[model samples]
Each structure stands twice: as C-alpha cells, then as structure tokens.
Target: MSLIMRPATEADIDRLVDVYFSAFKENPINIRVFPESSPQSRAFWKKNLEGDLKEDYVRFQVMETVDEPKTIAAFAVWNAPQKATNPMPPMPPLSAWPSDGEVDVAAEFFYDIERQHKRFMGPLEGAPEGSQQRPHWYLELIATHRDFQGRGAAGALLRYGEQQADAAGVPCYLDATPDGRPVYTSKGHGFREVESRLYQGGAYEHVFMIRDPRTSA
Candidate 1:
C-alpha cells in the first residue's frame, strides 16, 4: 500500500494518540514503566501530544495509507529549531496527570524513567563552555501502528527529518528502543550509538544515537 505523509493537527490528536499507544503498548520498557493501562495514561499522552502540536518548534507528522486515507499508519514527533523561545521545559509533574491513584503511580514511575534518561543524556544535551554548538534536530518519538509495522512508514518519517536536517546542515539525534536501532542504522543512515542504558532495573535498554548531516562539508 502507498503512503502519504503530512503535518498532524489538533484534529488528529485522538487518532494520533491511539497510534502512539497502540504502537508502544507491547514495548517491553513501556509495559514495565506503565503496565496498568489506566485512563491516566491515555490522558497523559493526549495532553503531551496536544502540547507538542501547539509548540512552534515541534513538527508533528503522520503517515497515512493512500488506500485508506483516513487511517493513520504511523506518526513522528520531531523537534526543530525555534527562535525566541526555550524548547526544553521541565518535566510535567505527576499532578498534571489524571487524579486516579493508579494513574498517579504510573505517572510517577514514568517520571523516574525520565530522570534516568536525563542522567544518561546530560552530556549530549549541552556543550562545553566557550565551544560553539550547532543546533540539531531531535527525534522525540516515532511509531508505526501495530498492523503496519513492516511497511516502512517509520523509516519514511525518519528520512523526512533527515532531509530537513541535511538542508539546514544540522545533525539528528534520537534515543532508540531496541526494536528501532536496526532501522535507524540501516540504509546508509549512519546513526552511531553513543550510549546505552537499562531501564526499569534492567528490563530494557535504550540506545542513544546520532546521525551527522550528510550535507556537512
């Protein structure tokens, strides 16, 4: 089936959230961190996706099968450069999630995971003082619908970011799940692993990788 990619809007939030959750529902680390599958998880994902769609620096895109144009096959959340604003914000508090006790606990558990991620990625997040740093595109999240896993939708989204970053002469960065690292490293993409860490007390590992601009000279 043919696929088309386009920017996702607020109107697409519900479907996009479904794509996100369904795509990651069986992911080992995701299950380990948020297993209860409560409404709180749904609400948290909705709020986060909405915030991303509203952010000027974020490029939210969805892939749809041309055969069924309304069906979202995959989606990507990318962070590009924006002037006059701080793109990085503090992690949302657990209180921001739904008030149910289970949801609150799930939110807290994921927050802990976020903290661990920061600890592993801190050095890459900034550069040494007095050194110039080139802005790079960040691949925050990318997932294919469970039914569309092998159809190349996710790679298309990654290539979209790569094309933009190449044109602008910037690198690309992502924290890849074990299932995704192979795709990111294949097809001459040239992503190199810089760090790897186990999450949820060694249940799963996330690999941080980077792809330098092919247009760099």
Candidate 2:
C-alpha cells in the first residue's frame, strides 16, 4: 500500500488519539500505566499532543494512504535536540495523569526515561567519551494502527526522522519494546542497543538504542 507522510495538525487530534490508543492497546507498559481508557485519560493525551505540536524541537508526523479519503495508518513523535541555553520543558508531571491512571508507575517510567535521555544525550560540545554529545533526534513515540502493521508505514515514519538526523550529522535514539527491538537493530538500520531496563518487576521491558548518522555515497 502506498503511503504518504505529513506533519500532524491540531485538527487531527481526535483521530490521532484513537490511533495512538489502538496501536498500544496491548502494550504491557501501557496496560499497566493506563489500565482504563476514560475521557479524562484521553483528554490528557490530547493536551500533551497539542503541546508537542507547538514545540519548536518536537516533530509530530502522521502517515496515511495516498488514496482519496486518506486514512491515517501510523504516527511518530520526534524530539530534535535543543541548545542548553534554551532547554525544553520537562515531561508532564505526575499530577497531570488521569485520576484513574497508575500515577506511580507512570511517574517512575517517565523518570527513568528522562534520566537515561539526559545521561546519553549530553551537551553537544566538549563532551566525554562514550557519550553521544551531539545535536541528535530522539524518537519519543511511534505507533501503527494494528490493521496497518507490516505495511511499511511505521518504517517510513521512522526513516523520515533518520533522514533529518543524517542531514544534520547527528544520531538517532529510541527505546524499543521487545517486539520492536529486532527491527530497530536489524542490519541497514544500525541501531545499537545501549541499555536495557525492565519495569513492573520484569513484566515490561524497553531497550534503548542509538543509530549514528549515515553518510551518503
């Protein structure tokens, strides 16, 4: 199926939210963190998604069939590196979670993500060894509608960010779920596993991977 990529807009929020929830409906971490899907929970996602769209450093893109009545097949959220002088705002606070959501688990998960992000993506200048201190792109989120899996939609979305990072002579970063690790680390992709962590007492796990810029022939 032919697909086209485009920047997501505020008008797409309703469909985007539905696609996001549908794509991760069975994800272990999401299942644990957001066991129930309420209007409040959806509201939180909508608000944060809007905030992401407005951020200069954030790139939110959606993929759709090229045919008429284009149907959104997948979406990805990327965070472009910013200068230290103007740091991006932190992730939404725990209080921002819905009343029925697993606040503690969600908080812990986000905390770990932030810690690893800051540690691995350090200053872009005069940095230390073994640190990717460069202006890189971070894959904050990527998902495809269940019915759309295996159609290359997700890979296309990922490659869009990879292309941007390559043009800037920087790397790309992402935390992959077990099911996604193989694809991300596969040859041609070149994402190396840098760290792995388990949450909910091993019920859920994510592997952090980094891909250096690829030079054109």
Best by lDDT: 2
Report the Cα lDDT for residue 165, model 2: 88
Per-residue lDDT for 1-217 in model 2, tens only? 7889999999988888888888989886676666536877789888988988998889999998899888898999999876555443477887888768778888878778877877777665665544434577999989898889999988888888899989988999988787898889888577899999998878778788899999999
Q: Please report, in order, the local distance difference test score of every candidate based on alpha carbons.
A: 0.74, 0.83
Error of 2 at 24 (Å): 0.7
All models, RMSD in angstroms = 3.7, 2.7
**lDDT string, candidate 1, 1-217, tens digits:** 8889999988888888788778888776555444436677677788899999888878899998788446889999998844313334356775675554345445545565455444433444356543223367878889888888889898889988998989988778788787778888886677887777775567667788888889655
Check candidate 2 and list the clashing pairs.
none
TM-score against truth, every candidate:
0.81, 0.92
Please report how far candidate 2 places residue 104 from its true position, in Å. 1.0
Candidate 1 local distance difference test against the native: 0.74
Supply candidate 2's per-residue lDDT for 10: 93
